[model samples]
Target chain A: MTSLVADIGGTNTRVALAEGPGLMPDTVRRYRNADHADLTDVLTDYLREAGSPEIAGACAALAGPVRHGRGRLTNLDWTIEEAAIARVSGTPRVKLLNDLAAQGHALDQLAPEALVPVLDGPAQPGATRLVIGIGTGFNAAAVHALPGGLMVGEAEAGQVSLPVADAEALSLAQFLAGADGFAAVEEALSGRGLGRLYDWASAGAGRPGATDARAVMAALDTDPEALRAAETFVRLLGTVAGDLALQHLPYGGIYLIGGMARAVTPHAGPMGFAGTFRRKGRFSALMAEFRVSTVIDDFAALTGCASFLARTE
Target chain B: MTSLVADIGGTNTRVALAEGPGLMPDTVRRYRNADHADLTDVLTDYLREAGSPEIAGACAALAGPVRHGRGRLTNLDWTIEEAAIARVSGTPRVKLLNDLAAQGHALDQLAPEALVPVLDGPAQPGATRLVIGIGTGFNAAAVHALPGGLMVGEAEAGQVSLPVADAEALSLAQFLAGADGFAAVEEALSGRGLGRLYDWASAGAGRPGATDARAVMAALDTDPEALRAAETFVRLLGTVAGDLALQHLPYGGIYLIGGMARAVTPHAGPMGFAGTFRRKGRFSALMAEFRVSTVIDDFAALTGCASFLARTE
Candidate 1:
């Protein structure tokens, strides 16, 4: 019998079967959430396709709040419950974790090849590490390195107020405040945040047009507005990263997870990301000593789910 | 045998002998650090006054950075070493903690009466709590409530860039930036912070006077400048507290410790502290659910030291 681990997002789901901490290479499968009515339906389909093998235990990671043994998809009108998963998947034991929390567990299992270095500072063994996810949404977690094991402190950090510093940023803040009455960190850091920045810049340049984050990023080289928007996005990411580094003092390093990480990493080198991060007055020296990396492995969450189940067992 | 607990600050030191978590009320003694040469001298004097009873273990909380069983007092020309304390106090075991870390442990030990509630929300039993100390120096810690126990995460949060809003705050930020090249949270939140706010406001009103925090506070009723300074201090405290609450997501509550908490709490009610804290746009409703309290007990660090020693043992 093998443990089944799954990461369920709003539009897609990744399922895998493994016996231990690492995900089984060939046993991983992806499914469209819209093709199924609920998580149980998708789990059942995946099991049947895999010849309905006996399951020892199961762990599921979702991009939403997990409380009372249940989680509701942030974008989809669906809820996954531990009892329902256990009954459908034929497992007596079931575990659920926040997507970012699962990503936090993946820190130890990530291979050197799976990471792209942003800052190569001296990292201490068994030091606390911080993980930040800037995807369609924003969230963070601190993985405490203890003598016994790692303890992850999950957070809804995107809900925090936005930290603005310049005239352009102040204008964006005013625009956000005008629309929502308060500007949250997520308003300037998420996928939609990129789009917002693009629109704001385009409007300021007197060439206003509606566009998504991808379209804006694609036009970065050709469109001055897009380039400006991208720069602002990179700078804002740096600012938030600096704030989190201070709040957590994660001397071990900071790991940026999720899709948007790739976009943020290229701009976070010696005097780009790390520069804005370390410009915090007297503590700049201490902040300079923190390492930063982007998790390039797409299957990290699956490996993390497997690790979580094994640890719980 | 009783464990000896001592909280050593730059100017004062409180020593006590306790058997467990709670302090031995009458056994507590306060001493002037200036009267002694170093921590060893203070420890030796305290041991002698306490009749030199058989010592079990000792935990000392000093206002400094503790690493490798050594600590340096931030405001004093002294360093405390575990070996030195163990040698002088005749104790086989000695533990040293950062003053704020010691306070983090006191969260669980504080009595209901010792907490002056600023926000009364439904706190989760095993949720995370944040402790912020705004004394001579500023720092904070996040206490994660785990299934097994509480894990305290230490922070040098004062060094992070300050978060500012409003014209007055923007003006203050500009002033701080001109002076220090960067605006850190501690520049506007500590004891000297009150004085800085008063000075800035007075300068703006063309009634400039160089006054310390104590003098400004004493002139609050009759002096308009002092009143404005006091108001700004309270509002800044709230803003910082709110930012911290978001950063840590301390749904369990936010506890204000040290000498400055009492002064800040009186102005933290509906339209004061709590109001500013719950003004975070869309997350305002959620922020309203966080409990805020001022720790009134002066012996909290002593009690915390006792708790830490007991837990480790």
Candidate 2:
């Protein structure tokens, strides 16, 4: 029997039917969450749209913290639970995975072209891999291929205090900390992080700062301050990514996902992302052995849900 | 039949027989590694002394990296493989685990008294756990109790660049970096780390530095600089531990092991380790939810070997 897979995000929810790990792309449909009362309502409408297809199991990737098969959306007022999903989707065996875990499961399923290589390292077939997400927020997950199924490890990595190596970096961290007196990894690596970097760079360089991440990236080729911010952001991202690589040792590869990762991919190679990533003291040599890339697939979480159900079902 | 288990260190190796996860205390014997030619010799001698009891499975914990079921001891000139151990122990099933992974496996088997609670947090049953080793070297492992068995995630975390938050901490990182100009986590967290912190503190106060870590801890009672160093060491350890807790989200508990951990345990509470640990800005509340403790068992690795073989066999 086919399985139902859905990726529920803050603004939109995408649902699809899956035959094992492979999804029926033609059946894929996106619906604004704002139009629905809750996840149950969304799933009900989607099932009706799909002609009430029979399903054996279902899995949903939610943008929130999951505990005991239940998850709550960070930006949406919805408590998504496995029981509710199973009730609506007509399956008892269902799974609710956090967004980052979904990304981790999607690693092996992504097309080769969707993973744009920014740094060189061999991706060992069955080895563990790390998926780092840098969108409106930052988070990470580790994927392990076990005998039973693929196990994705959880992380609130975005909330960890930011790492600063030099005087300039410390100054930037201080600038980011401001009244809070603490700067987390997300404070300098997510979408708004670029704008924060620009603000700090401009403040230091005696220039006007960009209004947002879009404006700063738009001025990358024209404005010197924006260029400096992009370079600094890329290097900081590399350093943080490098530290994570060492912590996880994801021999398969390190997949960078989310809005900020794709936005910075074109300039990462030139801005010395790999250079800063490889600056881990005596472990610098070991750093060169990791493959870092950006995930370009917008529907990765959906694929992840399909893959999750495939392995479990 | 009993299982054979051993923990191989640089200077000493502890060998024992196990009935499932429980180690036979009387069977446990410590051997000076310099006396034995290799692991096979030690195992052979131990078996001879025990009247050659048959072992259905065998597991050994090695103080080095393990790749493809083979391991090389960092401080000893030895190569250990599953097949080699199988031949030596007369068991076809043999597993070689890195020392940190072994510690990760030892978590559940550890005596309640052995785990002295350094910080208060609920240890959720069947949840993920973290084992952080800061002995002569620093390293950590994340333990997941999956369906198949306990899967310990590998880490070369000690080799990562040191993180700094403030001016004083940045100065300490700089001083620790020295000529290498790059200070890793091990540089500021392991056994030698206390000495480096003391050196930095002493040098800052225009006082004499200690000969080693032992001297610094010994001076903690009367010397203000030594106390300062200890305070810094404990606080830094907490910060790193807190960061790791976020990275792994090890709701089960965070177990601290090794010589450094024990030496600093008495001072950890008084020195504000928990205070620094919960300093993760907006996520401080989340940090308070993690249980941090010290694993005091001297033969934890040996117990880990037994536990691993018990689950697999």
lDDT on C-alpha atoms for all candidate structures: 0.82, 0.88
- Against the true structure, candidate 2 reaches a TM-score of 0.96
lDDT of 1 by residue, A1-313 (tens): 4899999987899998988787896998999988889989989988999999999999999998898899988899988999999998988899888999899888888899999998788777788899999998998888887655677886778877677665556677766663335677888788888898888898898886778888977897799998888888887788788889888878888999988787767766622676677778777778777888899999988888888777767
C-alpha TM-scores of all predictions: 0.97, 0.96
Worst 10 residues of 1 chain B by lDDT: B173-182
Among the numbered candidates, top lDDT falls to 2
lDDT of 1 at A156: 74
Query: Poorest 10 consecutive residues of model 1 chain A by lDDT?
Result: A173-182
lDDT of 2 at A289: 77
- Top candidate (DockQ): 2
Q: Model 1 off-target regions past 4 Å?
A: A178-180, B178-180
Candidate 2: chain B TM-score equals 0.95
| Docking model 2 quality class | medium
Clashing pairs in 2: none
Residue-level lDDT for A250 in candidate 2:
92
lDDT of 2 by residue, B108-164 (tens): 898888888899999898999999998888998999998778889998988876778
